[model samples]
Target: MIRHLVLFKLGEGVERDDPRVLEGVDAFRSLDGKIPEIRFWELGWNFSDRPIAYDFAINSGFDDADALRRYLEHPEHQAGVTLWKEFSTWVIADYEY
Candidate 1:
């Protein structure tokens, strides 16, 4: 199994209530149901003061690297990717299980 994790820091002036933020979160959470390769999905907004804490985090599970790649190319995932590029300042990742 593969675990795909992503942490995002929103761009300047972006807030929790922003449509872009909500759309990004909903888009990610919906992937498990929309894409076959996405076995699990979890997304959360940061509420901690830790420097490592980003604006949002996403954790996803896949059966293998191929499945993970497929999830990355999925249409719904692409929409989220576009939204991420528009609203995020930084994105960090680690993919290992």
Candidate 2:
């Protein structure tokens, strides 16, 4: 199995409640049941007040590299990425377990 992790930080002056940000969050949330390649999907806002924390996170599992690739290329996921591009910066990591 492989774990795919992503952490997102909102752009300067961007607030979570902004319409665009809300839409982006909803887009990602909608992916949970929409992609067959996903073995697991969990995402949420960070509640931490620490300076080093990211504003959002995506923790997902896949059966293998091909499954992970399919999920990455999925249309819905790409749409979500487009939305997020307007207001956030992110980092990702993937590894086998």
Best by lDDT: 2
Q: Which stretches of candidate 2 lie over 4 Å from their true place?
A: none
Candidate 2: tens digits of C-alpha lDDT, residues 1-97 = 9999999999999999999999999999999889999999999999999999999999999999999999999999999999999999999999999
- lDDT over C-alpha atoms for residue 59 of model 2: 98
Candidates' C-alpha lDDT: 0.82, 0.97
Q: lDDT tens digits, residues 39-97, model 1?
A: 77888888898976788888888888899888889889899898888889656464667
Candidate 2 residue pairs that clash? none
Please provide the root mean square deviation of candidate 2 (C-alpha atoms, Å): 0.5
Clash numbers, per candidate:
0, 0
- For all predicted structures, in order, the TM-scores are 0.88, 0.98
Model 1 quality (TM-score): 0.88
